[model samples]
Target: MTTVLERSPGSEAPPPSSSPLTTDARGRRRKATDVTMRVLVTAAFLVALIPLISLLYEVISRGVRMLSWEFLSTDMQGVFGDMTSGGILHALLGTVQITALATLISAPIGLLAAIYLVEYGKGRLARVLTFFVDVMTGIPSIVAGLFAVALFALLVGPDYRSGLMGAIALSVLMIPVVVRSCEEMLKLVPNELREAAYALGVPKWLTIVKVVLRTSLAGIVTSIVLAIARVIGETAPLLLTVGIVTQVNTNMLDGRVATLPVFAYSQYSQDALGVGADRAWGAAFVLIVLIMLLNLVARFISRRFSIAER
Candidate 1:
């Protein structure tokens, strides 16, 4: 039997393509969102940079003429009525010395405390210590300085202002920061590494020293840099405990000191503007440079440690 093909019923054609207007509307919405995000990002970046740019501009305009080798090298004691005579050398030296001493005093203690809290301590005491640490972190810088001064004075008599006292004040301020940072770093260390060390018959202390600390050394160093940076610019503590002087102070235990912050403060607290203002701007510029250098050093140290870890 021959089968004849049946004729198909009439059928509507497929709907025509969507209008260009619809496509254009979707494209416009996407473009609008993109533009909004770009604008927001640009605004945020500019906001972040405004203060820095303004500061740099102000300092450069006021200080560039006054920033000379003599201005950086000579001390301000004998200089009178002229911005060109005094330099930041003494203050810079004191700043370096005090901050170094403070870091040395704080870093070890804080790191050990963090190790104890993270590795050994358990339950309630750890919690209490942690809470106290948080509280310490919030303590005002001036309060830390006052506490140091009062405590030291009570112990060693009232005539006890020295560079060492300033260091101690800065150390008190730095410890909580170092502790918090180190504790976070230690916590980031994997438990598996500890277990493996234990399985290898290594002692807990050795395991921590060789494994945990090694793994977290970069972070620890970064914490230390942060601690240094935190205290480096502290004016109140140094002002109260160290007692600013124009001369360089090498002895932490004996004499008054001049730090960059104090030096900058003294310059800015002038009776009349003009030259003193110029000196203040110059000192500020120097401080900014010092801080920037420190940040670079921190980055370098972190990167080196990270590479060694790998």
Candidate 2:
């Protein structure tokens, strides 16, 4: 018996190859989409950086000449007018001291508050605290300074102003930031870690401190650094609370302080040209450098902690 191999009309011959144009069209579409996306993202990034680059260029160009050792070491205590005799010594010192004090005062309190909100929060109390924290976060820096002034004046006299006062105001601003950042970081810690700790018979507090905080320590540090950064450049609060002086006062409790922000303000506002202008630019450069250094430090710490975790 002979078997016949019959095929349908189109199937009688080998199937036709896919059209090259259709395949090419799809490939072209995908390529175009990818290129378009890349171009858009790169353009957006460059646009965002333009202002930053311009500002940096201006500051460095104007400020580089004033970065001499003598300019950095001397204070404008007795210098007057267009005389360029003093450096930012007093202002730099006060900035460091006040910011350091503010960080010390804010960090631990914020960390604890964050822990409470993340680990133990449940119900109405947490909600109330959260609402208050959100409110505090939005409070203006000037308001914080004013509040600090009013509190200190009420306690001491209406004539109270000191580096400590400035620090207190900065702390008030920093605490809410730290709290919010730390709370978010803590929430990122895995539930499994907590469960494992519980399985191992670890106490609740120990689990939180060891398993949770250690897991998110890098983020916490970064957030605290952010809080520091937030307040470091605030001119209004420091100006109001610290009340700048030409002379450096190491005793934060007793005398007015000269922070970089306030120093820059005083220089620029008092002298828009000549030596004062130069000094203002110089102060601004130093401030930018300080902030950059802090960011570098935070990056280093974050990397170190992350590596240790891994």
Candidate 3:
């Protein structure tokens, strides 16, 4: 049986509680623990942020001096070490072309695979594919570069370093990320949307295309952006597959090409106190700016699509 307590008519009401919680010992201990965890989490966040802030500061402070208009439009075709007059136009273009190619190659394949996994996968084949993708995700990037080189060498002679090869290598790194990220995004689409479309007698494929993909379009674009960023900053793969060039070459199937990461690596290779070091820092800054611009583009696309969806 439940027991009830009664209050006397002449007695004053109990004092207001000191907190949202009761003032018992257990409550007090729980509040103390909550405060302790909040303090620790805040401290950890600040600690993690310190390195990022320091890195940005150092890069911007050092790089801004050399990141002039001329520095962005010229290449070191005839210029030698320690001069640092040429721009990185060729390298910049190569980076854009190669990365775009990689994105083109990986995005569709990954998206389709993710669609299959989310919409139709239900058997052992899906599990095996997922396991392999997980394996690929952890594979060292250099291994991808090597595999690309070997594959191309078998088909196109032993000396096969090209922008196309670099893109292929980068695609190997990007596909798994695209698949995983797109899978998560696709999963976020509400089942109600799918069911409602199906109840309207919509074809399964049409429902997925119109309802599922459209609903998750924003997240899909964001995932692509993430995949691009993840691969754009990698150096080892490009170094082996793309090599380096001082001249402009827009052809992906042709000779050596330069990219921002490779450009920065080449610049940093010069003597410690030389102008090359400064140029390297500038290249790094430009790279960061390019990434920021790409992110802006992705955000714009997402917002535009979201508005249309609305």
Candidate 4:
């Protein structure tokens, strides 16, 4: 006997199967969205790149003519008026000396402080120290310069202007940056490594030195380089503390010194239309090159020396 199956009265028709047309439409929408996002991101990148390309073009076009062995070797001691018979030797020397001094002064202190904050710090003291570091990070470069000037003036004399003082000012700026960057880098280290070191009966300090610091060494170096770049181009602080001199003076305490930024400013201010302007542009080009070299060196060091996982 043949039996007829009956459907319930309240039962609705089964849902239709998904169609290829609907699936294709949804895939097309996704593709369209992805394409739109790519276009937007590319447009943004090109817009950001425009200014940098323009700046490089302007600097290179104007400054390339003035860059020479003579421009790199000679000092502006006797080159008076629009003579244009001088180079940035003195400024370059001062920039190197003062920045090196500042690094020497700030690096150890900042690293130690960061270590303390990250490893051993607890409770109210750590909070206070962190707060102070945060405040210092936002302190104006001019204020640091003034503080250095005032400190030296009170200790030595009112008219004391030297590269040492400029170094001190830069140290103030560098310290906060170093501390903050180092703190973040140290924090990025895994706690598992610390625990493993502890499980092996290693002392806390030894573990930090061997495991934590080693793991973060590359980042720490990068942070230090960034701090150097931040302070190297500062004109106001160096101008106030180091002052400008035509001849090279290597003594940090005896007399004024010239830095690239200060020298560029002085040249442009003194002679905007002639040889000085070209010299100023050339100094700027040199400064940019120096920063680029420092970054490259940092990258090399990071790659060569940083701990690698097996």
Candidate 5:
């Protein structure tokens, strides 16, 4: 009878009630933390947006009226006037060519370097490569230009200024950015996946080629686009190396290139501010649009590729 005092098999005592003041204090603290976090996030976003908003406002206010097809399509060869002047066609073309060439050179090297760093690299050489990449990252754009100028002086003589030189300088600037970005993206691919590929008896090279690269291809492409954007607006390198011209020169190996940034600099530096200033603003507008388009295209491509992977 003493052992037959029935009790529920799994039931437990209820948790003790917390004091009302303590409960209220905890609730208030949670609310306060939430409010503080919201305030901080809002402030951070505003701070981030202010510069971009200001730039867009200024560019639009000054250059909206100049946004005609004639202004963008016709080359500003000989025309000069006040507030109503020539176009940025040649500079636009040169900027495109120069950035394209730079991307062509940098993207491959950067992607390969990233692959080696993340996949094949394991020892002191990897560490050295990482250190060098870090140093390159901090090197000024002007220094890259100077390096290109100095290097070319030995090979092509003192008067050697070509779009190819400009591209090489830009490649120097772009490679580090691409390497860092692609390396990060590649690192995000799980070691578990790599191991699974290895478990399946796949060779390391094939695993990297078939699984690693494909998985990270979208990010690699985005990194390439971002690197292109980084160098597209460069002025100093083009100024020192390519030299500016009013006319179009398509050959990257020899002759003056008319990139948008250098074109803007030339226009603004002219003795008079009438037509030159106007054209400079217009070129700036075009450059902005082109960068914007590139970013959009990158996002689109990344999205499409990501969806396809899924």
Candidate 6:
């Protein structure tokens, strides 16, 4: 037991011990990499933000000068030439009516189709429907306008141009977007919930109505709002279908009607300087504000429903 062991000459040397300096250098290297990555990500974000900030600044600065109570309350019925005493009431009314009609037409159809696709669809029929929807989604806004125009001309008369026609055109553009978004939202619902409902003797339709739709209500609303936003700014469809009018026309089926986009286009085209240009900028500003309000409303609804679900 008193004898001590010794290393032979042919044996390998013992491994070197790690030093504090080596560990510290490794840690510093890792920290440096993390810092570099963070800086790069932040720089990228700022670069992306530059365009948006610049756009907002330009629009707000140019457009804010023309905004007033008078500009929003009256119509361009009598004001002509270099006269600056006109408003966009008619255009605003037309936009609201046409867009609302479009929503009414598209929302139910889109929601129902999405429900079928998500809850009941199967086999080849579903695939065909999906394919058609994909095709419709890519259809140009101008083509939708022309299609509506042709359909109306064939059904009614070749001289027809009305807010209803514009609504029809917008609905064409909006439905596919609604369907896609609603389908994705409905798919996000858990299967376990559906199964639980079924186990309780709930019918498939009732389960979809009560459990599935209620659960995804917020998302559905959001999708609808997004669809509305997508079509609301379109100029070609409204220009072709709704036409231009100076006075307010509440009846969507009657005569010509002006919309915000068309109004802006007409004004800008009439005169790039002076009163017409001012009116154009004002209309653009108003449209932007309207969209912002819609987005805010959607967010509020989403938050409320999310809280209710919790």
Residue-wise C-alpha lDDT for candidate 2, range 1-310, written one tens digit per residue: 9999788777656689876644788877887898999999999999999999999999999989899999889888899977869989999999999999999999999999999999999899999999999999999999999989999999998787788999999999999999999999999998999999999999999999888998998999999999999999999989888888988799989888899988888888888877888899999999999999999999998988873657
TM-score of each: 0.86, 0.90, 0.93, 0.89, 0.88, 0.89
In candidate 4, stretches whose alpha carbon ends up further than 4 angstroms from where it belongs are: 1-34
lDDT of 4 by residue, 31-148 (tens): 7898999999999999999999999998888888999999999899988986968999999999999999999999999999999999999999999999999999999899999999
**Ranked candidates (TM-score, high to low):** 3, 2, 4, 6, 5, 1
The local distance difference test score of each candidate is 0.87, 0.92, 0.91, 0.94, 0.88, 0.93
Q: In candidate 5, list every pair of residues with a backbone clash.
A: 81-275
lDDT of 1: 0.87
Highest TM-score scorer: 3
Candidate 5 at 183: error in angstroms?
Answer: 0.7
lDDT of 4: 0.94
Residue 170 C-alpha lDDT in model 5:
99
The alpha-carbon lDDT assigned to residue 72 of candidate 1 equals: 84
Model 3 spans > 4 angstroms off? 1-22, 307-309
Q: State the displacement of the C-alpha of residue 184, model 5, in Å, after optimal TM-score superposition.
A: 1.0
The local lDDT score (0 to 100) that residue 96 gets in candidate 4 is 96
Looking at model 6, residue 302 earns an lDDT score of 94
Q: In model 3, how large is the Cα lDDT of residue 290?
A: 89
The superposed Cα distance between candidate 5 and the true structure at residue 182, in angstroms, equals 0.8
